[model samples]
Target chain A: MNTKQTNEMQIEFDSKSENEGFARVAVAAFLTQLNPTVEEVADVKTAVSEAVTNSIIHGYEKKRGKIFIRCIMQEDEIVVSISDKGKGIADIKKAMEPLFTTKPELERSGMGFAFMEAFMDQVDVISEVGIGTTVTMKKKIENSSTFRVSGDELNG
Target chain B: TGEVKRFLRDDGMIKVSRSLKEIANKVRITKDSLNGTLNREPTLEEIAQELNMEREDIVMALEAVGEVESLQKTIYQ
Candidate 1:
């Protein structure tokens, strides 16, 4: 098997809902070399969706701006990093807490970090007020061969 | 994806057949990690270790569940 390819893919697009979905598909396809399962792909895609959504809605405050996404694949693992140079969060701890949101008008779930944690094994958020925010996420492929579906029963 | 406790369908194709337990397991997820793949979110590695499934298989499974849910809903009246 390939030792794993690590490279960064960058794309700047409008902070829009539709574009967020597009980015996820594009990234997933690009990372197909890791041979990620459907579920694994979906998991990463969701996390990306959440991060990009955060960048657009919270970081840019829904205003016109740019979003950057990077993907890195290492032996048995894939790392994805998302960063936005918009108004960075002063308190990442507070933003990560479930149900905590700075904007209620957007119906923000505030579960972005929670979801990221739930999906990825290791996730780190780096943010500097007035600078930008970067989220580093990693997932090991070796973990997949071990998730046994317990007591799964399919019937008509 | 997030706590994918169970997958109702087989091979991530379609839940053409599924028991109550299976459907409940797939539908009763507190999160949309699997269903919300259309958007780019960070990658979640724990699911592989927890579910013992390949990344592609997991996505297909979850997408199947989502499709099944929509199918069942459409059958209504």
Candidate 2:
């Protein structure tokens, strides 16, 4: 078995509509150390924005609450988790369906989860009604020619 | 009936929807014939065609008319 190094960062902020951009940029900046490609940065930014926005609009329902974001950097992958203590989803399956929004009056479009799934390699959503919801996403950093080949060379 | 929050655009125009698609649909219109100069109300498609831009791009810009919270106000630990 091979042991891989890991690093983590966590942040908590109010569930305000405006923090969506902040959360997106902060996650992108943190991933900069990994030397991700432009597309990779954009993918993470969009995914983070969706998750944070969902927490603000759907979870907290615009009420005052707190949102937590955690990023874990593994050997060649990054894992991101966005969680909130707002009203949880009663049916996560229906919520994940594209164009299915609980708040249609707000014109939410219900594309948040779809965008997250499209941008990231893996997306896991866990929720319990009346409790809260958490979204966990992961993506492997590609275009890392330097580290990728070096790690393989040492093994060969 | 519950109250719906109305978000104002940068130019003081109230947006009806938060989704880009909805905004695009709402803004789409046929060429108007009010005057010889295209009725002065330019549709997004016409503007895109005239400016050599993508209609989707124009809709994306128009959808963000709502106020966005600044990052400086965020509380980080």
User: By lDDT, who's the top model here?
Assistant: 2
- Candidate number achieving the greatest TM-score relative to the actual structure: 2
Worst 10 residues of 2 chain A by lDDT: A146-155
**Model 1: what TM-score for its first chain?**
0.83
Q: For residue B6, give model 1's deviation from the true position in Å.
A: 6.8
lDDT for each residue of candidate 1 in A71-124, tens digit (9 for 90 to 100): 776656778888888899889889889888887666436767877776678889
lDDT of 2 by residue, A22-133 (tens): 6876787667556577557767877898899889988999999999999998877889999999999998999999888988876447767877887788999999988899
DockQ of each: 0.08, 0.03
User: What TM-score does chain B alone reach in each candidate, compared with the true chain B?
Assistant: 0.32, 0.33
Q: Which stretches in model 2 have alpha-carbon errors above 4 Å?
A: A145-156, B1-77
lDDT of 2 by residue, B1-77 (tens): 01111121223332222343343443443333322376577765676675444454444434334323344467542
Tell me the tens digit of each residue's lDDT in model 1 across B11-58.
Answer: 342223333235335443412565465354324343533444334434
Interface RMSD score of each model: 11.2, 17.5
**Could you say which candidate leads in DockQ?**
1
Docking class of predicted structure 1: incorrect
